[model samples]
Target: MIRSLKEEIYKFIHQKNSLYGLVALVLLMIYSALTSKTNADSLISVFGAIEWIPIILIAIGSAFFAMEYSNNTILLLLYKNSERSKIYIAKFLTILLYGIVLATTSIITALLLSIVLKSRQYNLFTVIAGKTILIQLGLNILGMIIYSLFAVAMSFMLIMLIRVNAVVICIGLAWGFFGTSLSTALMKTLPTISNILKWNPLNMVFISQQLSKPHYYRVSQLSNLQLIMGTLFYSLLFAILGYLLFRRRRV
Candidate 1:
């Protein structure tokens, strides 16, 4: 498993398009900071900005697995007697690692930019200390990582089932944004079932915000522990389904 993971990591790092996403994420963070009126404002902006990270994770996940099928690389691995389960697990771990790096980069970029472009009218020390900005930063980053993993599993499942990169991406984007919102809205109409919506992967989008700012517009129905557990369950469920489909796939 370790060797497979190393191999998967090597493949991911060597992909030319991988760096582009990271660069874009950093630029977005910087821009968000630049337009902010205060350090705390920038912090909030950065946190909101990272909300789109699940889409990024989906794109990467789709492309990563799609390439293997499209290039017939999976056949080559099987020819070499590689265990399918190990390959799937390695890819999962690799995507999780990628999410960690992306989240960390976002947090670091946001913090540095906030410090550099801080508003002169605002007392930086007071805002930072009062809000416990460092702790919030950690929570935000962790939340993004969790969301990214869930997205990775979802995209991987779609990719394995569809075996088409473009379709996978389209479905991922549509569901990540529109489908989730629609579900949330519909759930609200049924007050009794609304509470169960919190367990949906899409609704967990505000997990980090709920942790750092309970008063945020989109409050979570689940407690922090419940949210975390729900996310893990969704991720695990998608991963298991993805692997099962991959095993039975013609490729």
Candidate 2:
């Protein structure tokens, strides 16, 4: 399991798409910081970049498995002595690790830039230590991590089922970008049946919003606990489904 995991990490690190994704993330972070006219805090930049995480993870997750299938490399891995479950688990871990690294780097980059360039007049350490900033930053980081896992699980399920990169990317992006609006519209349009769609993974991704806004229930029609539980439940549900299908899938 360790060997398989290591190989998965190594492959992810060497992948050109992964490298390109990092570059794009960095560019987006810088752009966001530059555009923040009033509030150019490290936390702001970090959160801004994180808004793109779902799209990034979707691209990474889809490509990670699809590449193997496209190159016929999955066949070679299957012939190795590793169990199918281990292979899928290794891939899932790779996605999780990448997401963590991406979020960590975004925070670090934002902090450095904030202190050195963005906030030259104020002491960044003091600002970061402030109660509100600290809490908000912590919540933002936590939300991004959870949502990243959500992206990984959902993308894994989609990619495994269709084995199509384009379709997975489209569905992932659509959900990431417009999911909240769609949910709201559904709730407004079908007030009677809206409860059924409220537990969807798309609605659960509003965790960041719920965390930042104390009055989130008024806006999202969901309590913080609901969002948290929904996120965890759907993430696990999709992951298990993906694993079950993957184990029996013919490479």
* Model 1 poorest ten-residue lDDT run: 121-130
lDDT of model 2 at residue 111? Answer: 79
For candidate 2, the per-residue lDDT at 242 reads 90
lDDT, candidate 1, 11-107, per-residue tens: 9999975797788778766665555554565575363455667777788888998888778898987776557899999998898788888877776
The TM-score between candidate 1 and the true structure equals 0.87
lDDT of 2 by residue, 36-62 (tens): 642434464373765787789988888
lDDT for 128 (candidate 1): 52
Clash number by candidate, in order = 0, 0
Error of 2 at 98 (Å): 0.5
Best by TM-score: 2
Query: Which of the numbered candidates is closest to the native, going by highest lDDT?
Result: 2
TM-scores for every candidate against the unseen true structure: 0.87, 0.90
